[model samples]
Target: MHPFSRSQEAKEMFQAQSHLYNHTFNFISSMSLKCAVQLRIPDVIYDHKRPMTLIDLASKLRIHPSKATCLYRLMRVLVHSGIFAETVVPRDGKQEEEIKAYVLTPSSCLLLNDKATGLSPFVATMLDPALVSPWHFLGDWLGGNNHEDCRDKLNNPFEAVHGVNIWDYGRKNPEFGNTFNTAMAGDCQLMNLVIKDYKEIFEGLNSLVDVGGGTGTMARIISEVCPGLKCTLLDLPHVVAGLPESESENVKFVGGDMFESIPSADAILLKVCTLGIALL
Candidate 1:
């Protein structure tokens, strides 16, 4: 091959490799977001109520100075993902020594824990190690290795990784169980606030049953709108065992398996697990 032809081929190969590598490691963005939320980076910037300098933000977070550069790198990716915005701030209102500051973008405003519709818990739950570990077994699962992880034998990727279904595993682990429940509640509540715009969807509905409704989050949210419409939330016994006991005017919890029987209703709602490995 000619020298120029070889160089062009090398450039093309480099571009292709970069593209493939970027897509392969895209999960890093989600992991970074999880870290920032866990550390309350967004909350800190929100509390400041103005653009926050990296040094001051770190001080507020009480992070050791050694990780200052790492923190900046984390924030840099977050800004690139549009979760946060970076801007130059003049120190003491002087332009001579400008420092980079972080501000919450519109996309991140929904991550606030104090907000009724905030998705902080949901994001945390989605990114939890217990939930994320199964992804490593996806290739194994697809390659016909999805079975027998010591405690339980199953074909699901999550089961293969955790030895049991997510719900069963969560039931045994209180911390993970609580996190899973809280995450679902936050997601449902946020969706509830959003679904109000589609009033036609709820029209003519007298009663609804929410299958696999963890902690009655979806039922509670929907019932608030459909005051006259009855809502029954059904989930695994272990899951519902930790949910509310008292019944609301329109909402009630039923600790039962959907496969056995779900409370009869005019409509049945299914909130599919998005982790892609959670089995029925």
Candidate 2:
């Protein structure tokens, strides 16, 4: 083929593969986010109070100086994905150095743990390996029947692959359970911001039930902000077990199965698991 014809064919091939390229590299985005969380990059940047240069960030991250180049490459991809932002800062008048400094955008801001509107937990929950691997079995699960009997089969793709529900697995593993709860609490923190904005939702509510309300984070926040409204945290017995006996006047804990029967309340806040939400 002529050189011009070959160039045209190459461009067409690239266009055809563009979507597949996106799909394949999607995991890199998640992994990059995961790396950031693991390295506490968001927290570091937040604490820095200013954009952090690559060397400074690497030092803060406890990464050796030799790995600085690798860090820069990772940051480049993250910046491209909009998880981190890069800016040029001038240190001295003599030379303006092109240093890669990370600044938090709306996306990275949500990853902060201290911020009232932080969504770190949502990220942790969504990216939980236990929860994520189930998606691979979606096609296989959907091939089965649609009856109530299939509910277990349908709702349990994770179990099918990993041999246990996420909660069960978390229970057996303390660190993972902590990570899961942190994520949930983070999500609750952010959600409460929205809920507070819509206070009318609780204007007439004397009592409210947070179904599957692990740790009562959301319910407690609601109860605290709206003192008159009593809150009940309804969750699995296993989840509520060993949690300190309630001392808060506005909030009470009730351990029970939401699938069978929800506790009686003026309002019910059924916080569905994200994995469950995704399946539905």
Candidate 3:
């Protein structure tokens, strides 16, 4: 091959290799974000009420002295991933000397534990070992290597890995079940911001049914924005059992499977019918 052609081919190969490496290690970014949430990094920064120096952050975290540098390295990854922001500021207002400080970005702001829109629970739950372990069996499940009877009955990688469906697994494990419920509620909180703007959609509608509406977070939001629209929240009997009554006259809770029979309404809302929850 010509010399220039050979060099160009090598360059292309190197670019391809870099792409492969990045895609292979993408999980590290997620794991790093999970670590930040586990450490309450966002909450710490948020509560500090100002840009926090690295040393101050470490001190607040109460991590051992030896791990301070490791914490910085972890922060570096999060900063690069846009989960946090780092900037240089004057040390104690002295112009000549500067120190690095970390601050919450919009993304990290969503992870604050105290905020109504906080998604820290969602982050923790999604990255939980029980939820993540199924990915390891994805190839096997797709290759038809799972037990024949199990494969015949199971629907997805999660069921194949855990030997049970997600709902059953949640029922069997109370701690994880609470975490999953909190995560779902946290995730649904974002709807509060946008539901009001779409109030017209509920106009002229007398009633609506929210299928799989866990704990009625979405129902309450809709009812508040569209006061005339009566909202019925439906889920498994166990999921809706013993729930406190809503203050809103427009919202009511009913427990039943979506597949069996959904309450008759002007419209049906199925917000969480995605592949992860529904297909599994």
Candidate 4:
């Protein structure tokens, strides 16, 4: 049958159906991007230092020759999604058929694993099997909890799926806990730049404490900016387990619960938005 064989009304119906299908499977785009990151495609393109042809990239990645076409297909989607850019690159010996090459986009640059501004850890954290598995249960939860409807299933979906709270689950899984901490640290590193943007926030402050500061990444940044200020980092025991207590320059890592009793400080830096100053 030729394309669009039916009446205009049927064609319109088919178009709407196609649109519904497109959105219904939109998670594929997100998964593909995550796969690209896991494969280190962004960093590979950056390491190449120039636009890299698909064949060259595949070869560098050590992918099977038979899968070269599939690699091309994946990159095609990524390029369309703006994770990578395509440009016609001329082969050294052949001028007739130019090979398409890929270059990293500004967005991919932030995903670099080696960069200070890297959000790769964040991506890894979000795309972890544990986190993604929760979504698969969302529909089931809405439908019913084995016997009863979702309304009867009072358990938190994540806890229900994993059998533990996110924090407890992380503490149980060292690898995941480290990744979560690193992801938070990466976010803090990115947010720490705002301190320079707003220097007045720290002005006249003699001391500070970063409540729930993971790995003291943010506290160290603030301490570096104001060396005279004594910075104490307070976090759960598991979180600050391996963090050096010898003072990471101006920041001190204290392993204790934040709810019990926080170390006193002139000013308390809580995340980015909130700040507290103690009375003299």
Candidate 5:
């Protein structure tokens, strides 16, 4: 073999190895983001009202002195991922010295607890063990090793891991059920932006049904945007049970299964249903 060809092959092999290593460790980024959200780092930074130094942030988080260095490392990863921004600012007493401070980036702004576009609940719920555990069994489920009967109704990883579907699991675990509901509502906050850009879609429609709408967050947004349009929110009986009535005359809630029947309406809105059982 030519010497140049051998060198070129070695370079390509090293590149492939680097690519593989990156993909294998990509979950660290997601887990780190989850950790940040769990600690309410975004909210803490926003409450600070300015770029916050590492020491001040550690103090605000009530982290121990021993863990301050670990906090810095975590923040470094978040800053690299663009979840937070780092800036150099003048030290309090040292005119010639500067310190690195953290600020909220556009992505982290959505994680703020009090913001209109807040999705902290969604982040927490999605990263919860109940949801993430399914991924561990995904390979087994796909390979038909998780179940004795491949033709069984349990066709998804969540069902294979938990021995029941997500809906049933939610019913069995009330706390997780509430968390999931809150997360769904929080996730729907993005619809506010969508409605603003596409308000014309609802103009001709007199009535619309939001199938499997959890707690009517999306329905309320639509109703407010299109006051003339009537919006009906339909979901499982247990999901809509004991919910307070909507203040808007144009919005109403109904308890029913989407598989059996859906309320009649001029338009049907189905958003985020594909991951309704698992990821969403």
Candidate 6:
């Protein structure tokens, strides 16, 4: 083999290994980000207008001075992943001794809990151990026997580990349920912001049904914006049971299953629905 050809092969191998290395260490990125959130690293940066030096950040985190180096290592990884940024700030107006200061990036800004529209809850919920532990079952779920357990009629991973379908789980556990509900509401809030861009769809519809519309938040907001359009909120009995009484005469709530039947309406708003029911 020519010398250059061997070098080219080695370069290709190096490129392949870099991709594999990224895939392997990706979990560390998630774990480190979770640690930063638990430690309130983003909040610390937000509170400190200027960049925070490693020593000061450690102090604010209540970590011993001895563990400062380890925190620096974690910050280095976060900075590489674009979660945080680091700058070399002068220690005491001397270039000889430069201190590393951390700043939150756009990605990390979403982790702040102080902001009203902050996605900290959604991030925490997504990273929760309960939600994550199920991934380990992927192989088991694939290789193991498929049991016909119908206690909750889960029929899938989200339902199996959660002990109920995603919607049912939200309904059954209101506190954790509300977290899921608010996440949906947050999405609707974003959609509502640009709703005017798609007003034509709703313009001619005399009535609409929102399937799996928990607590009627989306329907209520829509009805308020378009009082002339009658909106029906279709969800499980438990989900709609305690929704506040509607002031808009056009808006109505119904507790029922979407698989067997969806209440008749000119248009239907099917917010995430399970394949199990959708196939039926």
Clash count of each predicted structure: 0, 1, 0, 0, 0, 0
Q: Tell me the lDDT of model 1 at 96.
A: 94
Where does candidate 6 have its weakest 10-residue lDDT segment? 271-280
lDDT (10s digit) by residue, model 3, range 1-280: 8999999999999999999999999998999999999999999998999899998999999989999989989999999999999988899899999999999999999998888888898888888888888888777777785465676467888887788878788889989888877787888889887887777878889999999888888999998888888999998877788888899989999988888899999999989533275334
Ranking by TM-score: 3, 5, 1, 2, 4, 6
CA RMSD (A), model 2? 4.3
**What overall lDDT goes with each candidate model?**
0.82, 0.79, 0.87, 0.80, 0.87, 0.76
Candidate 2 lDDT by residue in tens digits, 217-252: 898788877889989888777778788755679888
CA deviation > 4 Å runs, candidate 6: 1-5, 88-98, 145-154, 159-164, 167-175, 215-217, 224-227, 245-253, 272-280
Error of 1 at 183 (Å): 0.7
Off by over 4 Å in 3: 92-94, 145-152, 273-280
TM per candidate = 0.88, 0.82, 0.94, 0.80, 0.93, 0.76
The weakest ten consecutive residues by lDDT in model 2 span 91-100
Pairs in clash, predicted candidate 6: none
Give me the overall lDDT of model 4: 0.80
Query: How does model 2 fare in lDDT?
Result: 0.79
Q: Which ten residues in a row have the lowest lDDT in candidate 4?
A: 271-280
Clashes of 3: 0
Over all chains combined, what TM-score does candidate 4 have? 0.80
Measured with C-alpha atoms, the lDDT of residue 154 in candidate 1 is 65
Worst 10 contiguous positions by lDDT, candidate 1: 145-154
What clash pairs does model 4 have?
none
Query: Model 1 Cα displacement at 52 (Å)?
Result: 0.4
- Model 5 poorest 10 in a row by lDDT: 144-153
